[model samples]
Target chain A: MSDVTGGGSGADDAADSDDAAGADFDGAQRTGDVPTLSATDVEAGYDQHQVLHGITFESRDGVTCIFGPNGSGKSTFLKTMNGIVPVWDGTITYGDVDLTDEKPEDIVTHGIATLPQGGGIFASLSVEENLNVGAFTVDDADAIAERKAEVLEVFPALEDKLDQKARELSGGQQMMVSLGRAMMTGADTFLLDEPSAGLAPRLVDDAFGLIERLVDRGAQVILIEQNVRAALRLADYVYILAEGEVQFHGPPEDLSEEDELMELYLGL
Target chain B: MVDIGLFTQIVINGLLLGGIYVTIGVGFSLAFGVLEVVDFAVGEYVMVGAFMGAVLAPLFGAEGVFVIPIVLVVFFAVGALIQPLIHHVTTGDRPHPLLMGLVFTFGLATFLRGSVLTIFGPNSQDVPSSLLTGGIEVPGLGTFPVVRTVTAVFGVTGLAVFMYYLYRTRGGMAIRAIAEDRTNARLMGININRYQSIAYGAYAALTGSAGVFIGMTFNASPGMGLQYTAFAFFMVVLAGMGYLPGVIVAGIVLGLTQSFTAVYISGNAVLLVLFAIIYVVLLVSPAGILGKGEWAT
Candidate 1:
């Protein structure tokens, strides 16, 4: 794990710097030009029930994985960032944009795109139509066409199914369409929630591979995952969330050394 | 003692009338399918359209040929204006979307009906018939009225244009996407309010156009709104919600049934049989004839 972080290619570091710089909205002094997504005292919940209890964290570049047991406010945290769930208190800042109280559609325009757990793709729409819808904000037809080609290049399996409806695709393929749709926005930051929730073990790796590609392409990704092993493998920074609060935040190798973290929280 | 020639003519008449029903019903289907709003005031738009055509006929002359475009624009504007308010009421933190839609649209229908009553009074008014007063005689079949033929032609043209717009245009695709999954559509950055307004406006225009055709054939009365509304509802139910092609087929079928029943049986039995058909169709396939599977592609 140390070797993976240490042997990071120059391109990877450059991309990280670019994304980190993009996320530096506060104009705060930093030791390095690291792009970061910061949340301070974020208090939010769904109608009469409070879930997140003033949790705070700063995610810098690369893959920031948030993992927890069921009902640990992981999904809620992602939802709050995506603007699906209203933020009752606290602030969320990404790059030069203050994302607190922003509409979900507006959030996408700010280079932050979100993918929910399931049913993200328009089922009745064709693959081409889905891609078109993904680029709703992009008025230039040529740009949409170019972006679509780029997205399809990443998900080659969908190339042949452009005219096919999204509902007709396999479960893994549907997930791909969802991710591809988010990518079509050309967003710098991606908030993915339980991307591999119902995928087979084989498809799980494929999904992670796509995330790694996004990270490699200079996009900052904050992911919530149930598959701890796969998530830790790809994540640059890991946050262990339990009971609506952060219990651990460090590199994957550091978390692996703590035996209690493995048994108590992770059930490993 | 039923004349076969007369029976043939009745069938032809029914088919033409079905064309008018299709035009009116398509709007209702569109509203139900995409917006998921059962617009109870759909019939009121038809009444308003007929009234507008009647009022404009004398001024425009040429048997209100010019009134069609004017009525379409007016109805479209009215629809666009009212849609946002309806959308807010139906979608605002409501427990049941369908119930909210029903209540809101029902209220709208009542209000519109009252307005028309106050303005037009209870008396039925006639539209100018100078444009399509003649009939074309067929070789084997009986003479077909120029009015029914012209109205049927216009109806078909309207349906074709609407279908083309829905299947071909980017706006149409967005509308279909919303109908499929609204949340996902919003996630894709498709503006829900704007699209809803556009769709409702188009629907109103189509229904209003049907009203012009209806006014030329029959009396334009404030009370006549409910009958067209019933026809549209019956047709939509028969076709299945959100299925465009099915609405067309159902409209024609219902029209034929009404025409044939009115001729052979009794005029009163037209609605009774139509309702019975709707009941049976629902029991057999709750999703309608098209099975509510895909948007009318």
Candidate 2:
């Protein structure tokens, strides 16, 4: 497991001790410091057609926003994080192990959880049953019970809707369940693809708020968003992708005045 | 003029026969629901169970009553082991589940039949002294064979136990979730491979039980697999795959239809009529009576 957040800020210093002793793939050892995931010059694509060209980035202890227009490979980039889509080149290191060729199950071992773009919840399963599945990797009954309580507390709406079939939930609520289910894995890092996609403005705000709160709890978030302005507001670091390549990589403050970014990337 | 007593006996026999039909169809239904895999080789499993019962029957002296439990356990184990092979092929990302599972299981069925022939020889075998020794007269409805009554008991008990296992247990819920949406279930941490294997294993066991039931009532032969295979498929299609209760009802209905036809028409003609009814039912309700979702193309 490669330490994704190892090189970020000063957080890595405090995480160093815990990473030395704790399971390499368990939740973050040091809440606000240790790096959770890192991708270095990663080249990934679909069926021999490359989509991400030499993508390099890192997420440490807070939300790292990825905003790009359509066909910029945002979803593809997210898939590579979990090895759902293989990396053709470069290395993706989670915690201390290299994940360039690891299976998706192995990726989960590194304490990184993913909630893919849309319709990720099991349609036929009742809401609570879906939540139970999130704890599948956890074998202990007590631990599963504790995690379920924790998840329901975070998303209290799910408590009342436990028996309802998941497909019956509103799109926004479904997204919450998807994220909450990922949280059940006790993963330190989250790979969220367009959490705001197809959501109403109010629901988008709710989704963004949830991401902010997760980051506040010392969880690392790698977010792929089409809502560029809203994402920048919540992100600590930003990467602008264009046609499978990184157009800009810096703090949000640096790109605040770039008129060309708004015209070409944001289309404002 | 028909003998009312004989008619009564035939009806009772048909009901007992339907019980076995339901067991066979239930296994087929679960296999399709979980893996979208059609188990053409299911009949072979039943054949194996029947032969195993026949072999065990003789060991228990002249009466095979003691061999019943032994056969169930042995056949259940056999089903569990054979399930992995079926899963191995159907696990691939292919759309033609029926074609793949059907063709592969067919090959397996042939191999099993050949093996049975080699071991048991090409001969029909049965339990010694008959599992049912005598019949008791009903006040108004003629005498019913004690063994046939026991067969019905086994059938209904099997269905009851299967239903309880599927709906009441934690593992059962997991299986239902997988059957509904495999990809989402996997994301939620449902080990697709583990649950699927168990489902297949259970299917095998169910088929085995049905086989043993059939063997005790009728003669066990390698060729018998074909008839049961066709009947099970018909029952599944008629009852709808995945709906266990519906399959049971369909099995009984099929049994009654066959019995009534056998009384008035040729045995071969009975099959034709049954298939004709099945076709009409499918035309009206494509998913079978209580199938999942709306009708299909």
Candidate 3:
């Protein structure tokens, strides 16, 4: 297994070392703030098959990345959090509010927004229109406008293409629109599933940077990524899920120490 | 050789007929486009509207023109009420939404037609109003019936309003988003059921208005529902599923083709020509004229 603090190219090496140092210092004195979201013994699945069985985790106030293999229920776990999938048995709490078996639309009102896989951008709609739809739960016009401005500031590329159809945009640009739309909701916690699923390497870096920026702006970002190495670099905390359960939960440096987890499970 | 005057009359007639087809077909197109459900009872709804206008004409007197609003409201309510039931039955684990919609709405068509037959009998009934029996003479070309011209104007205006609403309004955007992808629309905090019900109501209003026009221009009979239904289906298919503007253009083309065939060939040849056109169009572009296969959901 590669060293957690030193691997990849020069740029990645710098990022990895920085992440490791941050993990070491932060792990010694973890913040006392209440977790934005907590799941306990959460069980969920599609029709007949249960994909997430008795899984549990707590997402603190930063970028928490969930990394796993293909059938490890990472997507299902995100869906369960967003109330798209019903929890067979377990409790999902946002702050102190119980969120078990709630409707997905209602969940947005509680300040939890989700950007599902594939970006979920409305293809036929214009970029501005897509953002408008994202603010559906918000009634005040001024607030929506303010959030739109804030989102545009974060994604300057979308500022020029506000009137263009989302489908006309490139894959990375569409992902920007999707992220921008989610930001328009002004939610404190964002659940992003595979934000960099099919993008060029440079765009992937850009996506990770944007996600990190969200954390800097005081939003709790929970992300699921297939790119293990980049995820370890960007994640403030990491959870390695396999076979519908969490096998390891720690900082990025701790993840590197688990030889079996890094080699066999993650294929790092 | 055809006389220029006669040719002009034929063209005018074709366009006017196309306008009526547009009114009748737009609702069908919307239902299919947004909901992905073929509303087989659209023609029955039209027939119901015509019958309502005919029945209420005497009570409203020459002011029976006021009945249009009432017809629109009542039909919209009826559509909203029935849509949920249709959605519930067709959207579960048993069968695909399209197949279930076809079976359910086909049954609804038969039920509605039977109800009309039971109430009004098989005889065709004419709507008794000045709005129905009048004409305006045009210079050089010919005189056109006031009812047909009014119907055409209203149809075009309604279609224009619907198009604007779909592309510009928030609610319309929600509907279009749902049409594009139901899961994503829901994720965006759009209540899919409410929007779908509203869409059904809007569709009903359009078809009901078309029925009133049909009743005023032609006589209303229970069996005429099937003919209008067939024509609406043809227009929708020709325009391509979910392509709104294409439906309007296709309606005009179909109307013109039908009119020209009836005048030059025979009235019976209209269906034959329509089927042949549909076959050729499907063979060449399975997505219809302007359809890019984007709104498959």
- Predicted structure with the largest DockQ when compared to the true one: 3
Per-candidate TM equals 0.88, 0.82, 0.90
Better of 1 and 3 by TM-score: 3
Question: Lowest-lDDT window of 10 residues in candidate 2 chain B?
Answer: B288-297
Position B192, candidate 1: lDDT: 78
Cα RMSD of predicted structure 3: 8.2
For model 2, how does the per-residue alpha-carbon lDDT over B117-184 read when each residue is reduced to its tens digit? 99889989985545477987888887777877777788888888877877777777778878876655
For each model, chain A TM-score?
A: 0.85, 0.86, 0.86
Q: For residues B1-297, write the lDDT of model 1, one tens digit per residue.
A: 889899889888989999988988888988987778888988888888888888888875657546898888888898899888878777746788888888998998899889989987999998787868878999789888899998899899998888888878889888888887776677677777788889889989989988888899876999988888899889888887777778888988987999899988899898899999999988888678877624233
What is the lDDT of every predicted structure here? 0.80, 0.75, 0.80
**Stretches of model 2 off by over 4 angstroms after superposition:** A1-35, A41-54, A67-73, A86-90, A97-102, A196-202, A226-233, A240-248, A253-268, B1-11, B59-88, B91-98, B118-122, B136-144, B291-297
lDDT of 3: 0.80
Calculate the i-RMS of every candidate, to one decimal place: 1.4, 2.7, 1.1
Q: Chain B, model 3, TM-score against the native? A: 0.93
User: For residues B15-34, what per-residue lDDT tens digits would candidate 3 score against the true structure?
Assistant: 88788788678778877766
Q: Once superposed on the true structure, which residue ranges of model 1 sit more than 4 Å away at CA?
A: A1-35, A257-265, B1-3, B59-62, B292-297
**What would the per-residue lDDT of candidate 3 be over residues A1-268, giving only the tens digit for each residue?**
0111122224554565544343221111223332468899999988789899899998966888898899999999999998888899999998777889788877776667788887889888899999998888777675567568767877888999999999999888898888888876656678999988778777999888888776766677899999878877778899888999998898888887889888878898
- Interface RMSD (Å) of candidate 1: 1.4
